[model samples]
Target: MKKLSPEILEKLKGIKAVVFDVDGVLTDGKITYDNKGMEFKSFNVKDGQIIKHLRKNNILTGVITGRDSRVVRNRCEELKIDFHHHGIEDKFNVFFKEMSRRNIAADQVAYIGDDINDLPVLRIVGLSATPADGHYKVKEEVDLVLSSEGGKGAVRELADLILEATGTYDLILKKQ
Candidate 1:
């Protein structure tokens, strides 16, 4: 994980929710097709653990993806995310509705994205982040540029920062 600056650390303190983009943020931005025309995507268990840890500590976690897939649904189910809105044309639409429904302010949310479509939500969130391998535009716009690539603990890095900012990381560590 990269060292978070004091300003970024302060911003993270207000974060109560974290939203993610599935394809490039959760997976390695790869979509493999088999001869049988089945699609496959690999996800990191470390990322799953991070999500579980955050939720256990009362941080809301959610997913918003432009693409819909059974794999994504399964992964979100396994993580037990608070919100799972996928296959939307405009991500910010779902973002606003969900946040309003949850009574969470824009400053209380953190959004991680890796492409142009993620810009809208990322620009509005309290703490915006992107993976090391994220697109140039996305990287340039994010508050935190992670050291880890997608599907390789990028979410874990962000979760660790959030846990640390909220003074809950050590508590989770002690329980282990």
Candidate 2:
């Protein structure tokens, strides 16, 4: 994990919600399909593990992706994410709507995305992040560039940062 500067820490402290872009941010931007048209995407358990803590701490989590897949939906369900919207062409609009619905301000949300399509929401969010292997443009636009690559603990890294900043990580560890 990269060191968090005071400014970044402050931003993380205000993050009441964290939204993710699925393909490159959650998976490794890879998709595999069998001859029978079955699709597969691998997600990191480390990433999934942190969501429970986030929820326990009352931090909202969501997924918004341009592509729809049963696998992704299943993962979101398993994680008990507060929101999940797939096949979204206009991500910013959907994100804005969700934020409004939940009464969460834009400045209280953090978003992680790895592609150009994610720009609209990333740019507007209070804290924007991307994986180490994210597209160059996305890396440039994001507030934090994670040390881990996609599907290999990038989301966990971000979640850990948020937990640490919010002082939830220590509390969780003490309960262990």
Candidate 3:
């Protein structure tokens, strides 16, 4: 347990919920398209494991994305993340609604996102984060900048960061 300088360690301790924006933050922002207007995405397995651990710890986990896809829904279901919002334009609104529904407050939330669309919610969250390869604009305003790139282990990296900061990661690992 080391002292946090940016007040990051303190803020992280109070985080009861963590929100993620899909596409850039989770999937490397790459969209694979087909001839008939279909799209595909890739999600890392390590990401699922980490999110599962978060859930097991009872720290809320959620996903918000602008695009609606069955792939996203199915993966969330498999990961046991029922708090998800998709096809959303005003992400902040959806985020607040979900928070209210879950009985969570603003200061209890941590948001991780990339791109301009994500900046609004990121600004208001207790702690904000972005992946290493995220847009500079997005990265510049965040509270934490992860070393890992998105879709290539970024989610796991941040998840592990949170767990370790909260002093739960090592406990879980010991149980395993």
Candidate 4:
């Protein structure tokens, strides 16, 4: 894949909101079931911190997962994600809503996704990013392909790039 384009980087700099697709982009794309049928997902601590950093800088962040689970809801709550849309078969709806609610236009939004289901939003968003583990079709359509796999700090990587471009990453990290 081509390296991230300078044009793409410039576009990412204007992002005031970031959105992600959950099961894959946030959880390594693996679904585990317990004896009682409870579902579980693993989220990176660093990703959480990145989201906090973005929010602290007045940038809005949220999630739109295809599956519905308390685990996702809890994670969103922990991250203080304002627009949580789970069990969304149609990602564009949630995507458009979040953009409108945040008062951020499509050109000012970046979306991280991992599979064919994410193609629509990825195609329309200004900056589209895919994890290393994303499906081939999804990667083909994205503007940037991350070196890290989803749920393995991919979100953090994307967040860092966006924050850096916006010139707010260092400021946020100074508090750490």
Best by lDDT: 2
Worst 10 residues of 4 by lDDT: 1-10
For every model shown, the clashing-pair count is 0, 0, 0, 0
**RMSD of each predicted structure:** 1.1, 0.9, 1.8, 2.0
Question: Which lDDT values do the candidates have, in the order given?
Answer: 0.91, 0.94, 0.86, 0.86
lDDT tens digits, residue span 83-174, model 4: 88989999998788778876789878889999888898999988899999999999888888899899999999998888888888788768
The clash number for model 4 is: 0
Q: Point to the candidate with the largest TM-score.
A: 2
Across 1-176, the per-residue lDDT of candidate 3 in tens digits comes to: 33456588888888888888888777888988899978889998988889999899889999999989888888888888859888999999999999999889988888889788999999999988888888899988998888878887878877787788889999998999
**Segments in model 3 whose C-alpha atoms lie over 4 Å from true places:** 1-6, 35-38
> Rank order by TM-score, top first?
2, 1, 4, 3
lDDT of 4 at 8: 78
Candidate 2 residue 36 Cα shift, in angstroms, is 0.5
> In model 4, what are the clashing residue pairs, if there are any?
none
Against the true structure, candidate 2 reaches a TM-score of 0.98
TM-score of each: 0.97, 0.98, 0.93, 0.94
